[model samples]
Target: MSESDLQDNNPLDPGDNSNLASGEGHSEDAPPFVPGLDGDPGSDQEEANNLEESTPVESDAFNAHVFEGQFEPNITSYQIIWQGSPNYWAGRGGNKIVAICDHIMQGSMESANSWFKNAASEVSAHFGVARDGRIYQWVRVENGAWTNGIMNRPDTSLPWLAEAIQKKINPNLLTIGIEHEGLTGQVFPEAQYQATLWLHRNLIQNYGIQPDRQHIIGHYQIDAVNRPGCPGTGFPWQRLLTDLGATQPKTTTLTSSSSSGGFLTGPVPGVVSGAFGPGTVNTNNAYVRSYPSFGAGVMVLRKLPAGTLLKFIAYTDQGAVYKGNSRWYLIDFTDKGGWIHSLMIS
Candidate 1:
């Protein structure tokens, strides 16, 4: 496949390259791989034997099989079906696979495999997860797949990410893409979620990646404008992050006396109380709900005008993402404490 084809066949957008641009202030040169522990020298061979033994005599619901082909770096314990088109290049010079990006196939596994395996598609990912939890490997972990398109512009919300984009380096060079079999907004099956969790854990352990949102990000976060709804908002981000032990502390103590009056007489049931911190409303007429989620049958206490300063006590994860914000903070408004969406506050 041609480079243009590879650049044009992103699953999120087939022909949008407005975000593609040459990076600045950094060499286009890839990094060098720093060899690390490969975990139990005999593990791969043993696993290969086990995999062969575990192969079913007949096809069943989980008709999983390994593709016994050569890997780019030739270092993976999992079964990989070589279905990648010859459109990718060697990964970041260091043979490094830093991030694990998730994507929705927007179709069944068959269609995903068909599209990625076809040379004309020019799009491919390192791994694919079927609805039945079957895992397929298309590209080698050490190679770059034309999965995540170039980020032509820097994401100001994540300044730390600018370095990678500024180098104009393809994220495929540093990340492994896992295409989950499904359509946008569809909840991932339990089997698929389990399989992905296993894959992610293995990848994290193998690559020494910090199990955090920064390292394991959804495609939507990477190219928010171009692919805002990718992997869908229904994706259980909190569950995945919690499983990876990446959740951060939500409580912060305040020293100012302005919040003392708002403190409740006793700890509220099901509510995590803490000292208040200063925050400002960023949106007009933001509602302060009695609960984190609007679906929780909680009452909307009041509305705070934009630019209203508030004291936040704690935060909760209600799996609600309003205007790109998933967190809700417990704040004091009108002398009554309520939960406010993070998007409405700076």
Candidate 2:
């Protein structure tokens, strides 16, 4: 909850932030190529309405700070369930933490968790809060989930998002997203509110995020044109800020760091880190294969232009050796996310 819990390794320059403002940012599978739009408000609100309130369960465990911004064994009192998702950028590609955005799943937490786990979906938020006050973490705070990627809508008038839009940066890089499992218009239960309140306070404390309307915002603010009712009108914004109660931002600057091509937090004690960031295509008309290998049965998903940006999710030697190298990288895309030989992206 504290920005202190998150780090800003690659602070975004106000100008370079503009380079990623609109398009060429998130993968195509991601939504809102235009603006906010989650079709049916709450496809399963009836099911969510019957939820029971849960007491905040205490815990002393930590998380494996997936990226530089988040520290391992996340410090929290509430029992947090961690389920790592592949649908996120390994790191912010150097952008620092700035705001925490809230979203309403309009469905069940189980659905959100399942969606995030599927790499083919190419979407994720950092945390998810169930109607019963249970907390679940999918993507790490340090990485950029596919949640709020770009401000592509024509109308960019929301004050809460003015600074973000003017900066012209990929909102996903600067923001940590927390999804609430519920509908847009339904009243939030006290237990759920308190749980989210604890998270917001911690984010403010750790990252130095100011406890205010602008810093702590809803998903609608970013793309009011399309998703004006995202975290819905029922979210108690004023109450959350009042409870947070730190009048001013704790610090003037945010800090973060990256490893393994700007991938993980530092090194996990036993897990080995490898190249896991964005890479440019080095070859001309390269094909992203259905599988990592070059031999039989592999289908060509599509062709890529030279210098096209590709998100390399993981590296392995499972594919047949190509160009005297066995390194094959799994790249995230709209179509089931294909794997490309390292030589094309090396």
Candidate 3:
């Protein structure tokens, strides 16, 4: 997917060539076989994933421009799905395009090997989809990259949503929206949820976003005004909040019973009774990872601050803990280790 698709009004106008980075700067120049996803080991996707969405004032109005560094060499390849037309979300005359990527594949070969190279010929990169839950960005967050039009016509307004418009639902500037391929049906893949939380939390920290959660709204919540049942009813809303470390009213108390291998119990009460029984399996997909040192540590990450309380969602014998929507944290209890606090289990 080309970055040019995101421009409504280019603030830099550095010419088409400028935005297109050459071999030294952009990772697209690298061959499909790279070691890490972010192009470099130690190049934390969180650190290099700095997206600068500039809202420079011009002509008494705000002009938005999305400035981003090149993709990491580890991001082997990308499939541009649509380019000319908008996706299913953009009403009818929207300018948005969608792209799907295989981010966590092995050397040169996509783990799924299912490539839709021709997809971009039909749409733009207004939205991106990843097999994992992570959403690496390519566009700004303010302009209507073309998801939906504010003005349907000169006369007779199409009842354009005032709140949505005010929120700048433009696929161009206002959002860096992402769709997870594995999030089909009511359940999302364990890998997707964990990766998504890290991607989002990093984005929040990198951009210094206020309220943190405000910048990251789900596709379901976006069309809440006009469309109903968007993003589906089963979309993990609470998980998203917890993944981003955003605060919300407690819906249900997630408890970690000493039985059941000390796994975090589900919403139901007394079903498992926290017993470590036959069905209990130690897997990484069971919980969220809460890193205290931000982004450095063991197979999981780092430790949380002392006395920092975390809500527990589930557990995995894979040495990880899941706390929030997509928040999967590694469980550690060493001198350099950390602890995870649960809402139900103190």
Candidate 4:
């Protein structure tokens, strides 16, 4: 669908968003989760230090993208500077920026489309217009997009996480930037929150990046040399790290798997055509989603590319029903549950 279609269907509408800031989205959407003790910042600090020390060595596998012009050249004019020895990649006085305009998702679907489109086109970053926990990707993660910037030189101590970023930024290249739907202060719905965390976890595991608070920074924390308070303080930074199992900062490499596997299986890959239905037969496709109506606690055990294998995690009556047939397979990935065509699975 085009960007307009996505905006028209923005999930931020009151009717679409039922879980605002309740931390119901992903297990990690909740805020201010104290992992150890309220005062034990030492352990956290040590962990952070260790992660930094163990930071992964940069690679040249990623391709960097050409950074577009400023977000609002005339309107935004901020300056950033760094402190301490030039050896460290840390800076001070920079904060995130928030747009006074209505939340990206609360406005017209067209607005959502434009916002994401503009973000992707105007800036070098991975942008998505997410609603009700569903996210639409506007940019690929393979290329280094200009999403993060240093207000000053010292905000970062290490060089780009990889060669792509090194040429452009000291660290932005290594980071996977994401934009969520909602106003600056508005709380994201539980479904959306869960989706964010799930997606984050998937990215972390897929990319093998260490899951940590340091690596996962909110837009608010970013400063444009002088501009500040972006993305607003409302972002649940702590909660996101906890839920995604990314607490340690400075970790360079992640050791986990992010693949969710296939939802449908067929004799050939990508052959599971048609919309999801009850007993419609599933062909191996990893993109299947289970309708949330079936409730939770359902899982799938299959691989992608069709003609692979089969296994069921937890069965539920949620998908593809025949003319009057009453058989469903519970499907739940990234949180928003849904049904699929049975015949599509095979």
Q: Whose TM-score is greatest here? A: 1
Candidate 4 C-alpha error for residue 320, in Å: 52
Rank by TM-score (best first):
1, 2, 4, 3
What is the lDDT, from 0 to 100, of the residue 177 in candidate 2? 92
Q: Report, for every candidate in turn, its global Cα lDDT versus the true structure.
A: 0.55, 0.56, 0.28, 0.33
lDDT value for model 1 = 0.55
Model 4 lDDT vs. the true structure? 0.33
Pick by TM-score: 3 or 4, better one: 4
Instruction: For each candidate in turn, give its C-alpha RMSD to the true structure in angstroms.
Output: 12.6, 21.1, 21.2, 20.1
lDDT of 1 by residue, 1-346 (tens): 1222111222222233222221111111122222342321114443243223222212122122321232224222334444444334443455466678887766677766666554444566778888787877765566666677645222323333555666645566778888887766678888888878767766776667677766787775565544444576667677887887775445343333333233322222233355544666655567776555555355666677767887766555443554333556677544567667654554
Best by lDDT: 2
Q: In candidate 3, which residue ranges exceed 4 Å CA deviation? A: 1-129, 132-144, 147-172, 211-214, 224-229, 249-346
**What local lDDT score does residue 29 receive in model 1, on the 0 to 100 scale?**
15
Q: 1-346 in candidate 4: lDDT tens per residue? A: 1212111222211112223233121111111212322222124543244223211111111112212222212221211110001011221112121111111232332343343333122232344335554444333444333344442211121122223234432333345556566654556667666656655554555555556533555432233111122344445555776775654333111111221233322111111122222222223343343221222443333324444333322232223222111223333334233333232233
Off by over 4 Å in 1: 1-80, 152-160, 247-346
Which of candidates 1 and 3 reaches a greater lDDT?
1
For model 3, residues 75-114, the per-residue Cα lDDT tens digits are 2232222222111122212322221111111111121112
| Candidate 2: Cα lDDT at 123 | 68
Evaluate model 3: give its lDDT. Answer: 0.28
**Clash number for each model:** 5, 24, 45, 64
